[model samples]
Target: MTEYGYFLASEDYGPNALVEQAQMAEQAGFTSLWISDHYHPWNDVQGHSPFVWSVIGALSRATTLHVETAVTCPTVRIHPAVIAQAAATSGILLGGRFRLGVGSGEALNEHIFGDAWPRTAVRHEMLEEAVEIIRRLMTGDEVSHQGRHYTVENARLYDVPDEPVPIDVAGAGPAATELAARIGDGFITMSPDREAVDRFRHSGGGRQQGQASAHGGMKVCYDTDRDAAVRAVHQRWPNMFLPGELGQLLPTPRHFEQAAQLVTEQQVADSPIPCGDDEEEHIRSARAYVDAGFDVVLINQIGPDMRGFFDFYRTKVLPRLAR
Candidate 1:
């Protein structure tokens, strides 16, 4: 069976709002929670970036849903050792129901330190090393390490969960998917790409730990007015539609906005994001991920239609999909 979850966008909502949304989602029957950790919103129109750990702390107190960072970049802005400490505490606070989902970060958040953004290969190397460091620190013993991209000296997580916190590695391609299989406890991706999921499974992903989850997320703008939905999504997330490494290289919101301006509203209207209030359209978007072998799909309701979307999803969308 394919489980369903709600994705809480920290880039779009404050801590209190997110907690409220988690509660609402739980009441509405979501099985898990996915939250993004970002230093900045994708665009200014998205307009919020709360510290995700604080919100996660609030979530632990507010809901029982299994929570994971849809993907956190431990290689930049924050050191993996530090992330290890935070993740350890979160796991404990959540009664070991927290998973640390990680990935190679983007310049939008990783470049705030003024450090040069490494090339793609270098970034992936750093992420691999960071995951290793996080794993060692979770052992609850002192750790010291020196690697190509980071340095750690006698740092350890004195507080940790009873067991090692599960790692959910995010990937979009063959190489990343293979690496996720090598070291990750679960696989996380936004796209419904069967080849990637198949590669991970064939490369020794789900065999261990009984069955590692293949977690996916997607955005849907459920509004009565399709034009308004298109405009709002275009304003906030056109950057997601940027191809290649452009989204990874651009260092500022203005740079992203400039790039996003080239994206036409027609493109947003034509994009994969499921828009409008049609239950069939929403279900189809979700089934694509489930068909691709995802164990769970976290749906993000874009714009101001959260309650209405939840109502429709609980009453209409989920039942049909669950069958």
Candidate 2:
């Protein structure tokens, strides 16, 4: 069966709110949780970016829902070796219910560390090494390594998970899909592109029983007002609709907001996001990922309507989309 999951957007809510939302999501019949790991929100209007690990700890106590990072950038800001330790403890706290989803990140979060943001090629190189280091550390054995982008001296995860934490590497194209297939336990993507999923599966991704899986994420604004929902997305996530590397090039939320001024409401309306109170529209938007062959699709409800969105999905969307 295709599983449907709720996405916990750390950029849009505080840690406490996220914990509460986790409870709400489980009560509403969502099967899993997907949260983003970021040091900064995409734009100022999105408001919050609490440490995701801390929130995950809180979620561990609050709900039985399995949790996964939508996609974290472990190649920068923090060492992959360190992320390994965190993910290990997270798995233990959640009783082996944790998954780490990683990707090449945006400058909004990575640039704060004062390192020159490397180009895409270098970033991918870093990601490969990072994943290798994480996998070794997850084995609960002492590890040391020196690679093209990182160096690790004697490190190990003391509070290792009973079962290894699955790693999902995010990708957007054929090249990235191939990398995820080679290095990740599963593949993660933001869009519901069947072509990309096909590339990933053919390159040795998708379901393999004991191996790689496919995951996808989507965003929606569940408001009573359609235009108001458009305004919300245009203001908080115009970065989503940017054509190319603008998201990775912009260094801060302020920089993102400045660039987002170029994104019009019409563009936001034209984007493939589910908006307003139409149940069918919301279901249709989410179905794209399922239709693309994703084993699971994580749904994010943008703006300040979390309760309403959850209620609507519980009563309307989820039942209609149940597999």
Candidate 3:
């Protein structure tokens, strides 16, 4: 059976709102939670970016739902050893209900330290090494590593839970999917592209679970009009319209501002922003994820009408799939 969940943009909603959303999600029958970990919103026009780890701590205490970082990049900004510690503490706090979702992060978040971002191949190499370091630390055993990207000396996670915490890799391409299979406990992706999923399985990720995000599955513009929802998504999350450099090192939102200027709203909407008012379209978008071999399908409510979104999914969408 396919599991269902909601994606919470920590930046868009405040912590209190997040708590309410989690409670509402549980009440509405969502099985899990996927929260984004971003240092900055795709565009400043979006107006929010809260530290995700802190929010997760609060969510763990507030809801019964299982939580995962929709994706976090441990290769930069934060050391892998620190990520290991954070995950361990989060696992303990959540009573073993946390999964560490990681990826090779973008430059916008990591470049604050002024370090040059590595190339894609080098980033993957760094991600692989970082995953190994995190896994070792999660075992509660002292770990020391000297790798091409990182080095840790005699580090251990004292707050680790009794059970092992699962690591899900956020991968998009063939090389990344293969890496996920070899190193990740599961897979998380945005597009339900079957070819990528098959490649992941073929590359020995068969045993791994798969999860995906439905970009347009829940644009709850119930309170605001449909036009309002489209404007909100385009203004705040213009990058959703851009497919490249998501996992790469990047400049600020202004960099995207320049790039996004070249693209039209029609082009972005046509691509898959999912902002319009169509229940059938939402279901079809979500079904694409399931057909692509995802075990968990997480829907993100991009617009401001949270209650409307919850109601719409609970009534029109969940009923059809719950069976």
Candidate 3 colliding pairs? 106-248, 107-249, 107-250, 108-250
- TM-score of each predicted structure versus truth: 0.97, 0.97, 0.92
lDDT string for model 2 (1-323, tens) is 78888999899899999999999999899999999998999887888999999999999999998999988999889999889999999999999789999999988899886989998888888999999999899999999898888889988788899888999999987778899988888999989989988888788775544543888888999999999999888877888987788878889888888887888999988888987989888888888888898888888888688899899999988999994
Model 1 clashes, total count: 0
lDDT of each: 0.89, 0.88, 0.77
> What are the RMSDs of all candidates, in order?
1.2, 1.3, 2.7
Clashing pairs in 2: none
**Which regions of candidate 2 are displaced past 4 Å?**
208-212
How many pairs collide in each candidate, listed in order? 0, 0, 4
The true-versus-predicted C-alpha distance at residue 69 of model 3, in Å, is 0.5
Ranking by lDDT: 1, 2, 3
Model 3 misses residue 213 by how many Å? 14
- State the weakest 10-residue window (summed lDDT) of model 3: 213-222
- lDDT per residue for candidate 3 within 229-293, as digits (tens), equals 66666666667666666526447877877766655656646655456567676777777777877
Runs with alpha carbons beyond 4 Å of true place in candidate 3: 208-224, 246-249
lDDT of 1 by residue, 1-323 (tens): 88999999988888888999999899888889999999988888888899999999999999999999978999989999999999999999999789999999889999998988999888889999999999999999899998988899999788999988899899888888998988888899888989989999899888446544698988998888888888878877888789988977888878888998889889989888988888888988999998999988999988787888788788888888888
Candidate 1 residue pairs that clash: none
Give the Å shift of residue 17 in candidate 2: 0.6
